[model samples]
Every structure is written in C-alpha cells, then in structure tokens.
Target chain A: MKAAVIVFPGSNCDRDLAVALEKSSGKAPIMLWHRETEVPQDLDLIAVPGGFSYGDYLRSGAMAAHSPVMREVKRMAEKGVRVLGVCNGFQILTEAGLLPGALMRNRDLKFICRDVHLKVENTDTAFTGPYTKGQVVRFPVAHHDGNFFADDELLKRIEGNGQVAFRYAAADGTVSDATNINGSRNNIAGIVNEKGTVLGMMPHPERLIEPKLGGADGKPMFDALVEALS
Target chain B: MKAKVHVTLKNGVLDPQGKAIQHALGSLGFSGVDDVRQGKYIELDLAETDAAKAREAVERMCKELLANTVIENYAISIEG
Candidate 1:
C-alpha cells in the first residue's frame, strides 16, 4: 500500500509514524514536507504526526494547519483517501476544519504524559477494524493541550453518526470519568469522520507499537489501515 | 496609516494565560478585579490610504494568519 507522512516544522513524530506505516504495510511510505502544495498521486493513506508545530505558536496546530501542504491534505481527504492524525496532528485536523471541535488546554493546566486506558467504542472504521467493539486498550499520551471541546449540537451530531472511535476508560476497563486524562466532553479520546475515512485522536498510538516500548496495543491501529488498503 | 489588530479568545473558550494573569493580579493587591482576559495587539504600518481598503486588508490578514476564527475573535482599528 502506498502511504505518505506529511512533515511540518517541529513535527517530531514523523519518523515514528513512517516506521510504523512501513512495518505494517511492508513498504516505506514517502515523507512529504509541509511546504509542498500537492501530495503524490494515488496515495492510499496520509498521516499527520504529533509535535509542537511552529513551536505551538498562537495555538497548538493553528499555524501548521495553514501550511501549504494542508490544502492538498484537505483535497485528498475529500477524495476519500484515508487520513490519520495523531496528537498535535489531531489538533491540526480540527484547526483545518477536517474535524469538528477545538483542542483546548488541559483542564488541569499541566502537561500530562503517561499511559492512558481507552476503550474501543467503535470498531467498524477503516482505522479501528482490527479491534472489537468495547475492547479496552492502553496507549500513551503526552500533550499540554489535549482537551477536546465542541458545542452540544456538534457533539450530538458526532455521537449520532457513530464517529466516536475510542473513549477513555478506567484501568479496570470501565468507562469512567476518573480515567479521562483530559476533560474532553463525553470522555472522547478518538473519533472518525462521518464517512470513516479520516481519523483523529489525542493518544499516541505510534509510540506504543512495540512490546519493548511498553505495549503493542497500537499495532492493531496500523494493522487495520494496512489491511483496509491492501 | 497604521492599524492595531486585537485578537482574543472567545467568551466560552478557556484562556489559561488570562486566568493566570488574573490570579497574579489578585496576589498583587489588585482587588475587585472581575476578570482579566489577555489578548494580542499587532500593529501594522500600511501604505493604503483608503480606510475601507485598509480595514478589508486587515480583516483578511486576521482571518488568514493573525487569528483562528474557530476559537478567537479579532478587531482592527486604524489610525493616521
């Protein structure tokens, strides 16, 4: 499967994402810089990785969202190419209007870096098909502005469309408020677009792909994408 | 003409920097302060003479780069 990882200034996770994609798809994905106005022709997947793009200037992902590469990313997403955004990438997607809601500062006003438990709320999307609905997994999240915010109407629309892919869960696998790392409405950690072609999440699945890295729960996320395209 | 564009977070959006400023003010013997909402002021020196055109240009600048319309609001004031 042909894939590409869009790289922006201050994006530190590009290589990690590229490695994960290569291992899963059995082919090295192309690395596209943010200044490029177009993506490679016929790309099966596009990934926007995590980091403090533009030094998190103005707001997280705000400046990076306007980078030249984003226009092409938007066009590609609209054409039904599978797009995945993780952490700051997720913030960029929201800022770019590919997803709804704003990622506000963590409610606690502190940077949180740790493994978080999440439940697979929906497994039917191209990104989450490898997991079963209601299964629990653990992934690491390190972010300063990961709190997701959306109006009630938008939240309802997202929920009604089954866009929620993962929800924060307690260590015992129970969906509870106490386990929510950030004060995201409805305990949401990840979501997909209505068409299920685009996925964005605050957790760093790329960091958890290897057992030596702490857990292998993230392997399935990449596996699902590769399987969907292959 | 020059214009100063002020950009601020919307009412419902959380402002951590503003909150910190408010707390610091409270500790510094500034009482009865209802709230402190911090914002950015960007001064621009433009050669445009028409006020209407200047405002339009500033508005475009705010929308395109100076501000994020989803969470922040911006206003432009021009002076000779």
Candidate 2:
C-alpha cells in the first residue's frame, strides 16, 4: 500500500505517523512538504498529522488549511484518495471544508494531554473494520482545541448517515456527556466524510500502536487501511 | 488604505472562552454584565487605495482565509 504523511512547518507528528505507516504498509511513506503543490498520484493514503501548524495563529489549522499544498489535497480527496487527519490535521480538514463541524477550545480552556478511551462507533469504514462495534480502545489525546461543534441540521444528517467513526467513552465503553474528554458535541472524537474516504479525529492513534508504547490497539486501524487499499 | 475585520462565532455555537470571561467578571463583582463573547479583530494595511476595491479585497480574504465561514461570520470596514 502506498501512503504519504503531509508535513507542515510546525507539524511534529509527521515522522511519528510515517513510522506507524511504514510499520504497517512495509513501505516508507514520502514526507510531503506543506509548500508542495501536488501529492504523488499513486498514493492510496495521505495523513495530515498533529502539531501547532502556523503557530496556531488566527486559529488552529486555519492558516495551514489555506497553504498551497491543501488545494492539491482537496483535489485528490475529490478523486477518492483516502485521507487521515489527526488533531491539528483534523482542524485543517474542517477549516478546508473537507470535513464538517468546527473544533473549538476545550470547555475548561486548559490544554489537556492524556490517554483517553474511544469507542469505535462505525465498524464498517476502512479505518475501523478491524474493530468490533462499540469496542473501546485507549488512545493518547493532547490538544487545547478539541471541542467539536456543528449546526443542528448538519449534526443530525451526519449522525443519521453513520458518518461518526468514534466517540469518547468511559473505560467500560459507556458513552455519556460526562465521559466526553473535550466536550465535543455528541461526544464525537472522529468522523468520516459521506463517502467514507476521509477520516479526521483529535486522538493520536499512532501513539498507541506499539506494545512497548503501552498499547497495540492502534495497530489494527493502520492494518485495516493497508488491507483495504492493498 | 486600512481595513478592519471582525470574526465571530456564529450564534447557537457554544463560546467557552466567552463563558469564562463572563465568569471571571462575575468573580470581580461585575454584575449586570449579561454575557461576554470573544471574537477576533484584525487590521490590514492594503495597497489598494480605492475604498470599494479595498473592501472587496478584504471581503474576499475574509471568505477565503481570514474567517472559517462554517463557524465564523466576518465583517469588513475600510478606513480612509
């Protein structure tokens, strides 16, 4: 499976996502710079990783969303290329209109950095097929702006379409407002486009892929994509 | 030419920052302050001197890059 990790100036997770992708697909992903105008046409997946891209100026992901590279990213997404956006990448995707909703600052207004359990809400997607429905997996989530918000109409539409891929939940997999880690609307932690090709989320699944890293729950997510694309 | 732009979260969207500011004011004994909503104010110095064209340019910038229209509403004012 061919994959790439898009790197913005302040993106610190590009190499980490590349590590996980290489370990899963057995091929090192090209680190595509943010200023470049095109993605390699043969790529099956493009990952926008986490970081304070553009120093979070104006807003997180706002500036990076308009970078020259994003125009190509949007074009490729239209062609059905799978895209995974994590944390700040998720913000960019929303700011770019590739995904729905907005990620606002955490309700408490403090940066939260910790491991949280996420329940796989949709097992039918390419990113979640390896997990059973409602299965709870712990992933590291670190961000100040992770609260997801959407208009009522759009929220109902996406929820009805089963576009929600994951939701923050308790350790036992119970989804409740109290269990929401970042105050995301409907406890949403991740979602896919209507076509199910683009996935964006605030949690860092790549951080949990190795046994020595304290969990292997994240490996299957990458494996599922590689298997589907290969 | 100068342009001032205001970007604010749409109504019905939760403003946690604003809420915090409201609470902080309450703690300071400032009552009757119904609420506080925080927004962004940006000033741009433009080369376009025509008032109408400068306003148009800023409006385009607001739509394209300055504001996230899905969640934000932007207003522009050109100054002499």
Candidate 3:
C-alpha cells in the first residue's frame, strides 16, 4: 500500500511513523511537507504524526490544522483514503474537523509522558482490524492537551455508533476510570470517524512497533493497514 | 481601527492552567481569591475604518480560527 506521512514544521515523529509504515507495508512512504496542497496520487494511507506542531500554539493542534496540507488531507479522507493521526496529530484532526471533539488541557495540567495500557474496543476498522477486540496493549503517550471533550449528546452518539476504537484499561485489560491515562471522556484513548476511514488517538503506536523499542504490540496496527488496503 | 478579542474556556470546562494560577495565589497568602480563570486577549490592527465591518470580520475570525467554539468562547470589541 502506498502511504505518506505529513510533516508539519514542528512534527518530530514524522520519521518514526514513516519507518513503521515502511516496515509494515514493505514500501517507504513519502514525507509530505505541511505547505504542500497536493497529495501523491492513489495514496492508500496518510499519517499525521505526533509532535508539538506549530509549537502547540493557540491550542494544541489549532495552528497546524490550518496549514495548507490539512485541507488536502480532509479532501483525501472524503475519497475513502485511510488516515491515522496520533497525539498532536489527533489534535490536528479534531481541529481540522475531520474528527469530532477537541482535546483540552490535561486534567492535572501536566505534560504526561508514559507507557499506558489501551483496550482495543473495535476490531472492524482498518486501523484496528488486526488487533483482537478486548485485547490490552501498551503504547506510549506524551502530550499536555490530551483531555478529550465533547457535549454529552455527541459523546453518546459516537459511543452508540461504535466509533470508539480504544479505551484506557488496566493491565488486565479491564477499562475503568482509575485507568484513564488522560482525562479523555469515557476514558477514550482512540476514536474513528463515522465513515471508519479516519482514526485519532492520543497514544503513539509507532513508538512500540519495534521489539527493541520495547514491545511490538503496535505492529498489528501498522500490519492492519497493509492488509486492509492490499 | 483596532479590534480586541477575548477568548476564554467555556464554563464547566476544566482549565488546568487557571487552576495552577489559583494555587499560586493561595501560596502567596491571597486567600481572598476564590477562583481564577485565565483567557487570551488578542489585539488586531484592522485596515477597515468602519467599526461594524471590523467587528464582523473579527467575529468571523473568532469562529473560524481565533477560538475553538467547542471548548472556548470569544468576544470581540472594535475601537476606532
């Protein structure tokens, strides 16, 4: 599958994501700059990697979301291309209106960086299809504004529609309030858009894909991309 | 003409930065302070001389970009 990683000026995780995509898909992805308004033709997947894009100005992902590249990203999504956004990338997706809800300041007002357990809540979408539902995996989360917020009614709608892809869970894989890594509503760690073509999550799955990196639990997410597209 | 926009987190939305400021005040023996909610003040220099037009433009900027309506509210004032 052909893939590209969008690189904002301050995006530090772009290469990490590119490496993971290359390893999983057997094809190196193009590193697209944020200023470009056009995407490579017939792209199967696009990833907006994590980092303090635009230095997290005016809200975590707000400024970078307005970069010219995002307008193309949204247009590509409408055409059924799979899009993955992690951490600050997640914030960008929400701000760009590709994903619902906004990521607010973390409840404790601290930039949290740690390994956390996430329960795979949905196994039908391309992003999470390779992971077993209810399985617990470790992913590192590093961010300050990971708190996800939405009105009660909208929260219910996404939940009822099975849009939630991952929830913070204990080591045993049981989800609970105490297990919430960030102050995400309903302990949500990841969510997919209603179309199932886009996903936004706070955790960095790319960081866990190599065994030497810690664990290869994140490999399946990358693997799922190749499997679904090809 | 100049326009100033105030952007603040909506009521009931958690403001950790604001809470931190509150804590700092208490540590300084300012016990009379009950709460502290911080927001942004943005000043803009407008090319348009008409106050009404400037206000409308700034309001659009607030809704479209300046403030995230989902979690924050923005108020705009124009001065000539």
Candidate 4:
C-alpha cells in the first residue's frame, strides 16, 4: 500500500506513525513536509501524526490547519484518499474543515497523559476493519484540548450518519461519563467523515503498535489499512 | 487603522479555562460571580485608511483565521 506521512513544524509523532506504517505494510512511507504544496496523487493514505503543530499557537492545530500542505491534504481528501489524524492531527483536521466539531480544553483543565480504553463503534471503515464492532481497544491519549464539542443538531446528524468510529469506554467496553476521560460529547474519541475515508481521533495508536510496546492493539489498525489499500 | 477583534465561545459550549478562573476567584474570597467565559482579543494594525475597508478586511481575517465560526463568535471594531 502506498502511503505518506505529513510532517508539520512541531509534529513529534511523525516518525512513529511512519514506523508503524512501515512495520505493517513492509514499505516506508515518504515524509511530506508542511511547506510543500503538492502530493503524489497515487498515494492511498495520508497520516497526520500528533504534536503541538505551530506550537499550538492561537489554538491547538489552528495555525497548522492553514499551512500550505493542508490545502493539498484537503484536496486529496475530497478525492477519496484515506486520511488518518490522531491527537493534534485530529485538531488540525477539524480546523481544516475536513472533519466536524471542535476540540476544546479538557474538562479538568489539565493535560491528560495515559492509556485510554476506546470502543470500536464502526468496523466498516478502513481504519477499524480489523476490529470487531463493539470491541474495546486501548490506546494512549496525551493532550489538553481533546474535549470534543458539537452543536445539538450537528451531533445528532453525525451520529445518525454512523460517522462515529470510537467512543471512550471502560475496560469492559461499557461507555459512561466515568470513562469519558476528556468530556467529549457522547464520549467520542474518534469520528470519520460521511464518506468514511477520513478519520480524526484523539488517541495515539502509533504509540502502542507492538506487544513489546505495552500492547499490540494498535497493530490491527495499521494492518487493516494495509490490507484494505493493497 | 487599528482593528480589535473579540473571539468568544458560543453559549452552551463549556469553557473550562473560564471555569478554572472562576474557581480561582472564588478561592480568593471574591463572591457574586454568576458565570465566567473566556475569549481571545486580537488587535491588528492595518494599512487601509478607510474605516469601512479596514473593517471589511479584518472581518475576512476573522472569518478565515482569527476565529473559528463553528464554536466561537467574533466581533470587530475598527478605530482610526
């Protein structure tokens, strides 16, 4: 599967996402910088890794959303290229208008950094194909602005369209306010666009790709992408 | 021309930072604070001389970058 990882000025997880892609697909993805205005049209997937892009100035993912490369990313997304955004990457997608809703400050007003449990809400999408519907997976989440917010009408529409891909849940896969680590609406941890090709999530799957790295739960996501694209 | 823009979260959207500040105020023995909402204030100096033109440009800037319309409302005031 041909893929590329977009790198922004302060993107710390770019290499991690690249490594996960390479490990799963057995081929390295080209690292595209944010300044470049063009990307190869043949690419099957573009992963926006997590980090404090543009130093989280103005707002998280706000400045980097207007960067030159994001214009190309938006173009690619409109053409049906699969896009995965995690953590600050998710914030960027929302700011770029590639995804819906906004990520606000955490409810507790502190940066949370730890492992989180997320229930797979939709396994039909490219990113969640390997996981069973309602399956709970563990991924690390480290961010301050991961609280997802949407207006009542928009939230109902997004949920009605089955665009929700993941929700914070307990180890037993039960979703509740106690498990809503960041106060995301309906415990939302990730969501996809209506076409189901673009995904924006707050957790870091690339951070736990192998069993040696705490767990292999994240490996299936990369595996599913490689399998679907190939 | 100088343009001042205020970007505030829409009502019903939770403002945790504002809440934190409110809590701090309460801890300091200040009372009677009904609610608190925090926002961003941006000041811009523009080369445009006309008031209407400057307001128009800053409005575009706010729509494009200074404010995210989905969650925030922005107001522009231009002064010469």
Candidate 2 residues A135-211, lDDT tens each?
A: 99999999999999888999998899999999999999999999997789899999999999999999999998999
lDDT of 2 at A133: 91
| Cα lDDT tens digits for candidate 1, A125-168 | 88999888888899999999988887787899999999999898
Could you arrange the candidates by DockQ from highest to lowest?
4, 2, 3, 1
Which structure among the candidates has the greatest lDDT? 4
lDDT per residue (tens digit) for residues B2-40 in model 4: 999999999999998899899999999999887999999
Model 3 C-alpha lDDT per residue in residues A1-230, reported as the tens digit of each score: 99999999899999999999999988999999999988887999999999989988888889988999999998999999999999999999999999999999888878899999999998889999888889999999999889999878889999998999999899999888799877889999889999889999999999999889999989999998999897
Evaluated against the true structure, the overall lDDT of model 2 is 0.92
Considering the two chains of model 1, state its CAPRI-style docking category.
Answer: acceptable
DockQ of each: 0.49, 0.83, 0.82, 0.83
How well does candidate 3 score on lDDT at residue B14? 80
Error of 3 at A202 (Å): 0.7
Off by over 4 Å in 1: none
Task: Write the residue-wise lDDT of candidate 2 on B28-65 in tens digits.
Answer: 99999997889999999999989999998899999988
Assess the local accuracy of residue A7 in candidate 4 as a C-alpha lDDT between 0 and 100.
94
**lDDT, model 4, position A39:** 88
lDDT, residue A208, candidate 1:
86
Q: Candidate 3 chain A — worst ten consecutive residues by lDDT sum?
A: A174-183
Q: Stretches of candidate 4 above 4 Å error?
A: none
What lDDT is reached at residue A226 by model 2?
96
The CAPRI class of candidate 2 is high
Question: TM-score for all predictions?
Answer: 0.93, 0.97, 0.98, 0.99
Interface quality of candidate 2 as DockQ: 0.83
Q: Please give me the DockQ of candidate 4 compared with the native complex.
A: 0.83
